[model samples]
Target: MRRFVCDCGSPVYFENDFCINCRSALGYDPLRADLITLADWGGGVFRDLQGNAFRYCSNGEDFGVCNWLRPADSPSQFCKACQFNRTIPDQTRAENKERWLVLERGKKRLFYTLAQLNLPLLSGWADPQRGLLLDFIEDARTSDKYPETFVSTGYLGGVITINAVEADDVARATVQDELGESYRTVLGHLRHESGHYYWSLMNPEPMLLAEFRQVFGDERKNYQAALDAHYQNGPALRWRERFISAYASSHPSEDWAECWGHYLHIYDALDTACSHRLLDRSPESMSMSERLRAWSKVSLMLNELNRSVGRGDAYPFVINEVVAEKLELIDLAMDRLRTLH
Candidate 1:
């Protein structure tokens, strides 16, 4: 993420709704990908210093869960990022609002990175044939509404489903431990599931599909059966030699998505490092090989920094030779996906 500052020079954040130093209301302009200090223009409208009129997304105005702005005359109730939300957690429950807030923050961050990459993004509502949708729902784990339903975080059709309970720190940690995961977070889940969405969107042609098979294995393999075998036994032997994570060894598609997610993770982290003057060049200027090389140094420093502060490694997974090859293919695939925009 790029560093942001309030007009008064106080440091702000991507998720900020108000400037601390200037005490000014803030609104994020999705088109510009910038956080701007706003001046109330009256009657639920706001204007920046340049007098561009805007209104808070209905989700923001009503739920305080979003900080994005829409053009005052746009007629859409939601911001560009929020428009993809097909279902939000039921707001009647007191805890659901907080969960929704956390979920929205992750979604906005994911959208920001996707926009930065110049990827095509359309709402399922606008173009159901080739668009994305998000669903934040509750199941037996977090709500009484569904006593037997369990909503897993995943992508299917054109929609990404995230269990709202994943927003709760305790609940997430418990699952993380139960699953023997090294690291997990709301943003991580969003990025990973989005990989699945984009892979489907790509729908690679024969030659490209052949290359995908060469890099990540045959995606035509039985997915559910592979997953069942993986869970019943364990990750394939010597998974670390080829996969980004143990779970990535479950199937070829999972491997592709896992590598895709890591590509985003590395891109964002390297971009942030460059923005903060910790790196000399941005990820955009680097080839896949250069990115992998630079990420090695930066990720090492990141882990050391975390250790200094008494925290565990910020990034626990390693990019091995096989995984690096998969990431390179994913990088190329992203270039093709960008053409759809």
Candidate 2:
């Protein structure tokens, strides 16, 4: 993500609702992809320095879960990011408020990166067949109301359903340990599920399907059986030689999603590098091979920097030769999605 600066010259974060230094209000303008220090014009109306007008999305006004802005003259109450939500966690409870905020923060970051890539993002309400939607739901683990409810974080058809407990650090860490995962987070889940959503959007043509099989294997295999086998018997002994993560070895689709997620990781990291003058060109301007090579060097530096501070690696996995091939297919798939009719 890009570092934002308030008009008062104070550096502001992406999720800030108010500028600490200047005491000005802060909001993100999706049209310009700029986070602005707002000039309040009264009655919920505000404008940026360029005179572009906006107001907080209703989700923000009602629940304080979002910091995104909608066009001042638009009839819609929700911002472009919030429009994709088919269901949000119940907010009657105070704890759900904080959990929803965590979910919204992850959603906004996911939307920002997808928008940055210029991907086609039709809401499920807009295009019933191929559009995307999100649902944040809770299970019995954290809620007394749903004694039998269990919702796994995943993508099916066009909707991505995330288990609400994932927002709580203790709960997430417990599950992460139980599952023996090296890494897990709300943002990672979003990126990974979105990869599945986009793949459906691809609805790959024969030639593309043929190409995908050549790289990621056949996705037509029995998904449930594969997952059952995966959970029952861990990844192959040499899974790391080909897959980005152990869970990815579960199936071809999972592998694709894992590679796709790492592609975004590399894209965002390299973009940040260019913004800071660490690199001469943006990730968009580099070839896939160039990006892989640059990212290898950069990711090493990132991990070393984290170790210097007594923290774990920010990016824990390596991009092996086989994983590099899967990422190449992901770049190609994104190029195809960009040209959809």
Candidate 3:
């Protein structure tokens, strides 16, 4: 993320709701992708630097779950980001409000990277055919009120459904133990699910598809059967030599998505490292080999830092030769996508 400052010249963060120096209210403007300093102009009115009036989103005012700004000229009261939501968790439940806040923070971070990459951002409400949406839902497992429902966090068509329990620390930790997973987080879920969404748009040419197959295996295999076999029999014995994670070994398409998610992770982390002067090279300048080398070193340090804090590795997966080949395919895909701009 880029550095942000308040009107008082105090450094602020993307998630800041109030400037510490001047005590002015702050709201993130999704259109400009910046945290704007707002001046209160009396009852329900706030003005930006240009004297353009705005209002805190209803979600912000009502639930303290959002810090997004709604333009005064906008007919809809929802902010640019909130307008994309198809369904939010039941806010009447106090626990649901906190979970939804966690969900929104992850969603906003995801949007930050997407916008930085200059990728298209459209809402399902805007274009039913291709736009994206989110649904944060709870199931019977989480709440007695929703007895008949069982919602699994996954992506389908253009909508991403995140199980509300994933936002709860204890609940998520329980699942992590149950699944025997090494690493998992709200941001990881968002990034991985987004890979599925983008795959829908990845109409690679015949030659590119051939390359994809060579690197990630044949995506035409029976996905459900592969997944079932993986769950029942466990990952292939030599998975460490080929796949980034045990789950990535389940299916070819899954391998692609896993690699794609890792690609984003590496790119974004590298950009931040560059911004903070931790790296000598920017992501745009680094070759695939350079990025892999840098990431390997950085990832080791990240794991060590987590270990020091008595937490699991922040990024537990390993990138082997085979995974690197797949990642190169993703780099090619990203380059091809750039041409579409």
Candidate 4:
């Protein structure tokens, strides 16, 4: 979420493929965690200002759905992030291309935050037992081709499935209303599902698992039955006193993922604030407790800024004492994951 600039002193965005001022081709090099302005070096190769050779990820080159770069010598066609894709939307459909673009944007942002946190992110192709994968697909509700299939945005095994229609604003909003959810977005879904992936990746030891149970409750509890009860009855009474969102009250695993998603949200926002010079220090330099304290003030300012523009609150949930404790556990878990990386 940090601001980027082209070499010509022109501000560029993360998603920009070319600089407006210098017309320099832009590509994000994940290895360097930077956006580099590239010069055409012929034969589909490019060199950055420092003469680092690179090639556009095939997804970017063929489908215009990614902006990441890979080493010119790499055997793989996909970027580190796109390598996680198990299935993408059918690109032959004109509308699916646009939907895939939006989905990729959300996914890239998720990878950015994950990289910033230094978390382990291997592709399922690399490590089928523990690695991650993604599926951007359609079902009966969104396409006639799959008349009996219903795809829910969720994570199972190593794959995260995002129903492609979530990319459509109206469709997502309609589902949000029908489910009586306060907020939902593609990025939110991506972040939440990533929590599941990493949680499975962690496979915590006895001590850490015991700590997690103490903080977030026993994840061993029946997940489906809990979700069924939650939907049939609604969120637990006084859920706001203990959880980040109403849906978080559905299950212990869900509470963990909700807290994990909000942790990323707060960290990314704080990092952006620091990059803009609105904050004196970056979240990386702060402890988990410090970041939470900073977010408490920052979230309020963010809400007020949205109000000034006649928009809804940018962040609608509250992080109560109980939730803060759970987030702290998540922070500790991230630290452990970083060590494993």
Candidate 5:
């Protein structure tokens, strides 16, 4: 993520709601893609330093789950980001409020990276037919009130459904341990699900599709059967030599999505590293080969840093020559996908 600064010249963060130095209220402007310091002018009117008038999102005022800003003159009270939500967890339960906050922060970070990559973002409410939406829901397993309901985090059509428990650290760690996964987080879930959403748009030209098949395998296999088999027996040995994760080995389609998610992870993390002067090269300036080389080195150092702090490796997967070729395919496909915008 990019570092942000408050209008008061105090260093702020993407998730911040107040500026420490100026003691001014802060809201993230999705349009400007920055945190803005606001001054309360009384009577519910808030103005930024440039005199841009705004209002906190209704969700923010009601439940403190949102930090986005809406224009004071906007016809709808919801900010650009909040307008994309089709369902939020029931906020009557206090725990739900905190879980929703965690979910939104991860979603915002996902949206930020997509925006940075110049991908198109539209709400289901806006298009109804093609636009995207999110649903953060709870099931019987997570809440007693929701008997007979079981929700899994996944994407279908254009909607992404995230189980509310994924936002809870204990719940998430339990699943992570059970699955024997090396890395998992709210942002990782969002990025992975988004890969499914984008795959629905990957109607590449005939030549490109052939190339895709050569690298990532044909995606025509039965997805459900593959997933079922994967869950029953686990990934094949030496899976890491070819796939980004054990789950990626389940199906050709999954392999693509897993690689796509890693592409975003590597790109965004590398960009942040460059911004912080931790890397000598910028992602935009490096060739695909150069970028991968830098990423391999940086990721190793990152893992070591975690080890030094007595934590697990920050990134636990390896990127071999074969995986690098697949990633390059992703880069090409992303370039093609952006043209649709």
Candidate 6:
């Protein structure tokens, strides 16, 4: 979430397509990890001032669902981020198009953070066995067209399926209330589900699995049974003392995903803080304990600012000593995972 500036010295945002100040067209270059102000070279091709040739993602040209750019020499019509999509809502339907647009915005933001982390990313098309992909689908609850379908926002076999209704704020909020959730958003769901994708990539060894069980719980436990119990009986009275969220208490695997999601949330927030000059160092330079200590001061000020504006706390969750230890394990595991290839 770093602040961006247009070439004309005007403030720009990551999602901006046209700069309001200089009337320049903006395009994000996935290779350079930058938003460039484009100059029309000729006949639908564009060039950054540095002479890097590019083209807008096809979705951007056709449906305006993306703002990313791909190298002109590349054979792909989609940008690196869009290449991950295995399916999308029907664009012919106006409502579905609008929902897909909102969903793309969230997906792009998620991709931006993922790129910033320097994690290994590949489209499932490129590596069918283990690469990541996304699918935006709807079910009976969200639409009348499919009365028997039920698609949850989840990751399985390298595919992330996000229920299309999650794009609609009212629908999402209604579900949040129905489920008694304190916080939920399209970005949060993607972040949490992506943890499952990467965890599959990790495929823990015996020692690692043993360590994860000690920190979270027995991941070997029945997932469906645990979820059934969670919804039926609810979390323990002191759940917050251990889990980052009530849902995290449902199963050990979920605990891992929740911790994984928060690990990302913390990184992005600190990255933003550094961008704003409120923090003096990059998150990569800090230890896990240092990050927690820094986040405490950072989150406290953030909560106070939210209170000042009469909004709820910007961050509703806290990391206790136990959670901190779990995060450290996640950090270590990710470091090892990243080095494998």
lDDT agreement of model 1 with the native: 0.92
| Candidate 2 residue pairs in clash (backbone atoms < 3 Å) | none
Q: Model 6 clash pairs?
A: none
Q: Which ten residues in a row have the lowest lDDT in candidate 4?
A: 141-150
TM-score of each: 0.98, 0.97, 0.94, 0.98, 0.96, 0.96
Tens digit of per-residue lDDT, candidate 5, span 228-339: 9899989967898888899999988888888888988998889889988899777878778888999998999999999999998889999999889989998888888898
| 10 residues in a row with least lDDT, candidate 5 | 141-150
| Superior by TM-score: candidate 2 or candidate 6 | 2
Sorted on TM-score, best first, the list reads: 1, 4, 2, 6, 5, 3
User: For residues 60-157, what per-residue lDDT tens digits would candidate 2 score against the true structure?
Assistant: 98999888999999888999999999988888888999999999999998888999988999899989988999999888987889875667999998
Error of 3 at 299 (Å): 1.8
- Report the lDDT of model 3 for residue 331: 82
lDDT of residue 132 for candidate 3: 88
Residue lDDT tens for model 1, 1-341: 89888888898999999998888999899998999999997898999989999999999999999999999999799999999999999999999999999999999988999999999999999999999999998998887768757779999999999999999999999999988999999999999999999999998888889999988888889999999999899899999998999999999998887888888899999999999999999999999999999999999999999999999999999988888889989988998998888
User: What local distance difference test score does each model get?
Assistant: 0.92, 0.91, 0.85, 0.92, 0.87, 0.88
Error of 1 at 204 (Å): 1.0
Model 5: residues with Cα > 4 Å off, grouped in runs: none
Candidate 2 accuracy as TM-score: 0.97
